[model samples]
Target: MSTRRKPQMHSSERARLDPFIVATGDASPRDQQDLMERPFFSLAKAKRVTPILYKAGYVQVEVYAVPEHGLATIWDADVLIWAASQIVEAENEGLRTSRFLRFTPYQMLSAIGRQTGSRDYKLLKGALTRLQATVIHTTIRNGENWRRHQFSWINEWEECVTRDGRVEGMEFVLPDWFYRGVIDRSLVLAIDRSYFKLTGGIERWLYRVARKHAGRQPSGWTFDIPHLHAKSGSQARVSDFALDIRRIAARQPLPGYRLDIEREGRRELLRIRPVKLSTESVGGTVGTLGTSGAGGIGTSGAAPSGLRAQDTQLTLWPETLIPGLNLESNLDSNFDVGPEDGGKPAPDGAASRSDTGRSEPVSPDDTRTREAQP
Candidate 1:
């Protein structure tokens, strides 16, 4: 009898169809870190931000949110950080990493130093939803010709459930743009775990700016206060924005960076310097990771007293006070605004241009401002 025999599948073929999965055990090693150089997430609170278009020079960024759903905040970047860390770790271990990542809620929350409570789990889900829903239109990686590309932070995601209706795990696909950036070794940088402890949004944004610009260079970087305001994409008035910078400088909270305030002919400049590893080990206080020096300059020995409490405050005069300074000229002169020429290596050694352009600092006549809500 010609019985229809079921075709046997090869083991390799079976594995290709259903690969074995690993659980995040306590002993699981943490992954290397990665951060996006360009400003992607909004620093303002989701509740306060409106669907707005931010433009500086030739670069333009548009952020949109649904009616009930608010825009993604800087805190949402935590998810990206976790994803980047995992991908980099996998690449380093010679394991294949993909857009589709399977992970438990606990694994993600714990890795980012977030609490593993039920509320935190719900919050995580909400963050994921916002990330998926928030749409961004930008000319970042697009060439100088003004082409626009649009994408969400995440492409798609879904959760797995057990027969008992308990959530088992989740899987999400990252956007190709973000994935490509993470996989490229040059685009990634290691940040201190203490970054999570930062309490202010401006503080968090400033740290990213410092990391992207100063990198590991001993000389660090300098940004004019007015220019920095223009680059922050903040809706705050220039005076208030500058005040926030002063307050953050007074606290000296950012990890791996030292803040110094300088004055040049009435122009106030914020200088960010990389703290030496040795100095970090000796003086870092927030977490075991490293040091805290609000006023003292790093190895550069510029001036220890420059950023002291007294010196941290900026003095504004009406004539030099160019509120909402013109960004077109500043963008071209002070920063690298053009896309990577494709052949030349990026200054920071990254394969791609580290930043498209600095965010235009917002200027308003009113000095009064509201503190950003958490």
Candidate 2:
């Protein structure tokens, strides 16, 4: 199959959004909190057309994938992470950004640590295909009311090809919800660039979960394995999921944090601890991990003049057992959506919840990592 993208000179992108050229790289990676905590994508490289039903207190999410593209695997999320990093990087520099982004395929692939050969370019196209085809229904940032939104990861995407058939550039529009989430400072966190090195799906998801939850809080965070299983959105049974997590813990593959599986009475729990050695993680407010202004980082800027707030300690993030999040009888079902439900996802799908859990670390010395990559 050809990876060529015919010119998209006449698309909805022209009528509205002005293209923001991606001319910079080496920006610190940032991820959305709600997406990091929830089951937003499939975990494996294998094709999955199944639906992911997840709920956590006021948060609700349901994901459906078209059979042709299958589901967007967690690996595909690297695109979003790169997009988010670009947005936040520009914002912090006082520049305007848009959901519409234009860049060479090579720029993004290299930044995200993916191989930039012909086959990798084909995989990049595959990632875009899955992202555009996977549909999501969620209530993450909905105001005070109870409303859900249905949208795909990408509204549309296209590539620039010369008459000589050489691809020169690419562009894609992110869903509004995701764009807004990236723009909101409180919703994003800087992650280690080495996070891209992780190959296993579960470990990648676990690292994000740890980055979002454990953060720089000295005490770190921990979660019950069962609650962790439910929040993970894995198709594996609880026992298998627990085993997978235990193996990851044994390897401790998460970049800036340490993982330990512990037991109390009869229940097993996974703990996340931040290494005192790495001061590279930035969260919520502007901290040590903001972009380094490398390669003319943003298009706009004026040094800010004001009183900047600092976080003395972590606060108010949801817990594994929040008081009022009603749990339905069947919250743990790993269901699939066949061809009948694939073409069009129901906008008003049934709601589900995932508990936002945390764990405390075992020891500091054993987990001292090399700090943030790039």
Candidate 3:
């Protein structure tokens, strides 16, 4: 006679961890635009072990990508956007938000406009892995001493699964650096929905650049091709980089910005201008600038009573803008308008001429200005 003893369940198997909970409500994700200024991630899909060291006078950023995990890409930024938007929305609603967020893969994928298929789910997991693996060492927030602070994009993450081995949701903790930026409010901005559709990496990067630098300003910002190349931390040759910029300019794929290529002497420059607002809105009371003074574009002339110029004549990385950083000397040479073109004043209200002794706009199609709403 076989006596079957009652099976005793192991304590570990008996204990069921409670799933993380999130407040039931709408999600409003926002991304800090300041991040676009630095090259914290790789633009390519290929594995990148080469560390990127970017130096412009006192401003220095060092990025190290793990060989096995590769560097985070612009696409991976969607995760941050989702996180930021959710946090912001929660804060606005007086709801609680935490670094450890509980969300199903479908929720995240759908929010970011990614397909919720199994393959896409796998890709989402890979993106999280890369974000956690890629390390960034910078002096961005650190003061004059140049004490390097190292941190990954994501601190830690875990997947919640059901008894059937089906993924129920995921929880990830954001690094302090990113979390602080998002809560600051001033560092965040509202981006266009069309931003997700940009296919090319450079085009996406360029859109961020435009949003960060140009914003809703009409005057926009100008960057020398060489300087932009160096700041981008791209492995491509300068010529190739210039070609890509030209292509992007031709397409005008960026939502709120109008791109123009002009020659300043032998130097090629990319001008990013914001699309004008509608006449009806322009007539209304003056609208506030969307970015902090430290990171906003300057205005030119006195705008209509309620309207103001979005452009400014100041340089991007001036010491005044980023205290303890001295970029004037390093960038002066690159941005210097050659003496050859100094005497010739560009046509009034027309495109400015470059030092290359050629004052004409590169693409006629870019000359027509378009209107966009923020």
> Model 1 off-target regions past 4 Å?
1-37, 143-146, 162-165, 277-374
Question: In candidate 2, what are the lDDT values of residues 1-374, reduced to their tens digit?
Answer: 23433334454743355445566434777887668868998885568878999865445789999987777878788788888888778767665566777677766766765555665666678788889999999866564443688899998997765565655667798887787767766567777766666667787789888877667655567788888777778889999999999898887667778888778799787878777434332221210111110011121112111112111111111122112321221121112212111223323332211122211121222222322221
TM-score of 2: 0.72
Local distance difference test values of all predictions, in order? 0.53, 0.63, 0.56
Residue 55 in model 2: lDDT: 69
Q: How many backbone clashes does candidate 3 have?
A: 16
lDDT of 1 by residue, 295-357 (tens): 111121111111112111211112232123334432222232232322223333323112322
The per-candidate count of clashes, in order, stands at 7, 12, 16
Q: Estimate each model's TM-score.
A: 0.66, 0.72, 0.67
Any idea what lDDT model 3 has?
Answer: 0.56
Question: For model 2, what is the C-alpha lDDT against the true structure?
Answer: 0.63
Clashes of 2: 12
Q: Choose 1 or 2, whichever is better by TM-score.
A: 2
Candidate 3's C-alpha runs over 4 A off are 1-29, 144-146, 276-374
Best by TM-score: 2
